[model samples]
Target: MNAKDPITVLPTDTAVSQRAARELLSSIEQAQRSFGVASVVLTGGTIGIQVLRDVRAFVENGFTEADFSKVEFWFGDERFVARASDERNEKQAREALLDHVGVPEDRIHAMGAAGEFETVEEAAEAYARELTAHAAADSTLPRFDVLLLGMGPDGHIASLFPGTGLIDAQGLTTAVRDSPKPPPERVSLTRSTISSAREVWLVVTGEGKADPVAAAFAGEPADVVPAGAVAGVESTRWFLDEAAHSKAAERGA
Candidate 1:
C-alpha cells in the first residue's frame, strides 16, 4: 500500500491506545479464523507498551475477544541486554500483556538475550534462523498479520535510525551497534523485512513526535527519515494521538 494511505488520530494517548487494542484484536481474530494461526510483530515504546496493556484490559473487561494463543508473537526489535534487564522489550511486553493473556509460551519468538549469545551479531543471526523455522512453506519468513512499530522522535523505526546503513539493511534481521538511543546493542528486523508484513502500523503519540511524523509522511528519503523507508506489502497505516498528528496535519498529510 502507498505511504499516503489512512491516518487515525485520537484525542488522547489513552484513546489512541484503546483504539489500537481493538485494531490488534480484530487483526488477530481475522487471521485465526482464516488459518487457525496468526502472527504479529510487536513493538516497544511508551505508546506501544500502553497499547498492549490496553489490549489485555479490553479482553479481560469483555470489550473484545482475542485468541492470543492462536497468534504468534514476535518482537520488531530488542535491546541486546540481559534477559531480565528493564531495557528488554521482551521483558516489558511479558509483564504488560503476554502474561495477562496467558498466551502459549512456545508462541513467543523473542530475540536472543545478552547472555544467550557471544555477540550481538550471533543473536541477530539466531533470531533470523528462528524466524526461518516458523516460516510458511516456500518462504523464508512467517506471514505477519500485523506489524506494529513505534517511531522515535527522530523518525527512526524498528531500530533503523536515520543517517545509518541499518535504514536500508539487507536480510531478515540484523545487529545494531552504536544506536543513537542506548542500550547501544540491539537486534531488529531489517527495513526490507519490516515492509514485507501484510499490514504495518506506526503507532506514535505526543507533541515530541510531531516533527518527524511530518517529515516521514512528506516522503523524505530513508536516510533522512527511516520511518518513511518502508511500507507493508498490503497496507501501511499511521496511528497517532492529536499532538503527534499536529505537524503532519499541518503538512496536509
Candidate 2:
C-alpha cells in the first residue's frame, strides 16, 4: 500500500495487542506454507513489547509451536549498548518471546552490541554484511515476510528521527549517533532496506502518536515525519488504537 493509503486497522488499546498477536502468528503460518521458512523483522517499544508478550500467551494457550520453529526473527533497530542491557531491543524481545518460543538460535539475527564492535559505525557495517549475506540473489535485503515498526511521538521510526540525515539513509543499515532518545547511539535498517519487505506494519498506540499518525497518512514530507517515508512492497498497514487514530479521524482519513 502507498504511504497515503495504508490499510488502517483500528482496535482498542487492549484489543489491538491481542489482534496483532494473532495476525503475526497467522502471517508466519502463511509464509511458511508458501515458502520453506518465514522471516520477520521485529520492532521495540511499549506496544511492540506488549504484542510480543501477547504472542507468548497465545502460544502458551495451546497454539502449535512447530510453525514458530520455522520462523526467523530480526530487529528493525537496536541500542548500541551491552547485549544484556535493558535498553537493547533484542534483550527485551528475548525476555518476552524468543526465549519462550523455541526459535532456532542461528535464525535469530541481532545487531552488534557494545563490546562486540569498536564503534557504532563498525557495528552498522557488520550488520550490513550479515544482511547482505542473507539477501536474495537479486536483492540487497532478505525477503522479509513481515516487518513490524513503531512510531515515536516525534515521528521517528526505528532509530531514524525526523530531520536527521539518516532519514534518507541508503544502505542495508546505518549507525545512528546523538539520537534524541537516550543512549544517543543506535543501529537501524535504512528506509530503502525496510521498504523491501513484503508487508510492513506500523503498530502504534496512545494519544501522543495521533498527530504524527495523521500527518503520515496525509503524505507529510519525510523530513517532517520520517514515518511517511517507508512503505512495504506489497502492503503497508497501520495497526492503531483509538487514541492513536484520533487525529486521523478528525481529518476524515
Candidate 3:
C-alpha cells in the first residue's frame, strides 16, 4: 500500500482489460460482503473505457445482478464539456458499461458538464458538495472501497498535471484549465481525495505510459509525477500491460 512501491500486476495487452474487469468485480463483491454497499471511483482513458467494456461483458457472461446493484460509481475526473460529448468520461462509461448494467441511476455520480455550471470551478465545487453530502458526518469523503485510475503518459493522475497548482489543491475536488491534453478544462478529484480510498488501482496500458509507470514506482516526487502521490488505505495496485510495465521492470519494481 506504499505510495512509492505499489503491488504491480502485469498482464498481456490483450488480456489486461479482462484481468482488470475480473479484479474489479471481485473487489466489489468483497466490499459488498463486508458493507451493505460499495463505492468505486472510475477513471477515463482508452484503457479505462476498454476495462468498462470488459466488465460489462463479464457481467453478461456470469456475474450476478445483485452484485452490480450494490456498487455505486463515481468519476475521478471529468471533462468540462457537454454530457454527450465524446470527451465526457461518463458518456464513454455509459456506452461501455453503465447503461447496460443494473446499477441504480442515483448511484452513478458524475461531475457537472459545461452547460450545468457557469465555470469549471463551479463544476468542481458542485461535485465536491455532492460528495460531502453522501459522506458520513465525521468524514469529508465517502468510504471508497476501490478507486480505479489511468495515468497520463506524463505521470498525471486524474487531472493533476506536473507543475500545476491543482496538484496541490485542497478539498475533495479542483478545476483544471489549459490541460496539456485536449479539451482545456476539467473537474478532478484532488490528490487528497483520491488517496482516501481503501484501494487504489492504476490500470495502465501502452508503451507510451511506460516511463511514467517507472517514475511512479521509482519514488519520484509528487510535484514531478502526480501518480506517485496516490496510495490507498488498505492496498495500492498497479495493473499494467507488458508494454506499460517495461520501464518499471528495468527499475526492478
Candidate 4:
C-alpha cells in the first residue's frame, strides 16, 4: 500500500549502494529458490552502477553463496549506441559486475547495439521479442525477479521522462527517438513491463533529486513524476540517501 508506505532512507550514497547490494543478493536467492532461475532488470546512472560494484565487493569479500552465473541480467533501458561504447548501460553493467561475476554472455540479454539495427524502433522490437521468448508458458513477458530503476532529478525512470508520451507507452518495450538527455536514441522497457517485476526498487540519491523524490512520495501523478506510477507485483522499494530524502523528510514522509 502507498507504494511501500514509508520509503527507506539511507544516510549516504554509499549507504544506499551498500543496501542495494544486500537487497539484490537476498532477492536473487529468494527468486532462485522459488523459480529455479532469477532475473534482474538493471538501470544505469551513478548510484545504479555503484550498486553493482558494491555487489561485486560483497562477493570478493567472502560472500561464498554469491552465485550469479545462472541469473538473467536484463536492462530496463539502454542507450542505442555501439556495444563497446561507455554510454550503453549493458557495457557499464558488464564492466561493473557481470564480468566479475561470470554471469556469461547468454544470460546477459542486452538490447541491440547502435549498428546492429537500422533504427531505434527495430531495436526496441528486438528486445520485446527476446523478452517474449523468455516468457513463462502462455505469458507474453518474462518474470523479472528483481527490477532496479534509477530516477532522475526530474523523477524520470528508465527512458520514460516526464511530459513524454512514452510515460504511457504500452507493451513491453518502446523506442525513444528524442530524449531530453543526451544520446537521443534509446530502447526502454515500458512501465507495464517494469511493474511486472516481483520486486521493483528505485535506487536514487543526491540533493538534486530531492524535489522529485518528495513529489513522488507525495502521490504526484505520473505525468508529473513518473516514479509515482511504478511499483511491483510483490513489493515496491524506495532507496534514497539523506540528501535525496531531505524534502520528503521535511514533509514528514
List lDDT for all candidates, in order. Answer: 0.90, 0.88, 0.87, 0.90
User: What is the per-residue lDDT of model 3 for residues 139-234, given as tens digits with 9 covering 90 to 100?
Assistant: 988899999998888999899998776679998999998888888999999989998999899888889999988888777888888988888888
All candidates' TM-scores?
0.97, 0.96, 0.95, 0.97
Q: Judged by lDDT relative to the true structure, which candidate is superior, 2 or 3?
A: 2
Question: 1-253 in candidate 1: lDDT tens per residue?
Answer: 2456788999999999989889999988889888899899999999899999999888899876568878899999999999999989999999999998879999999999998899999999999999999988788999998999999989899899988878878899999989999989999999888988999999989999999989988888888888877888888998899999999888777
Q: Write the per-residue lDDT of candidate 4 for residues 37-108, one digit (tens) a residue.
A: 899999999999999999999888876464688799999999999989989998889889899877878999
Total clashing pairs for each candidate? 0, 0, 0, 0
Candidate 2 wrongly placed segments (more than 4 Å): 1-6, 9-11, 64-66
Query: Ten-residue segment with the worst summed lDDT in candidate 3?
Result: 1-10
Off by over 4 Å in 4: 1-3
Residues 65-131 of candidate 2: C-alpha lDDT, one tens digit per residue: 4377888888899999998899899999999999897888999999999999989999999999989
| Order by lDDT, highest first | 1, 4, 2, 3
Clashing pairs in 4: none
Model 3 TM-score (2 dp): 0.95
In terms of TM-score, which candidate is stronger, 1 or 2? 1
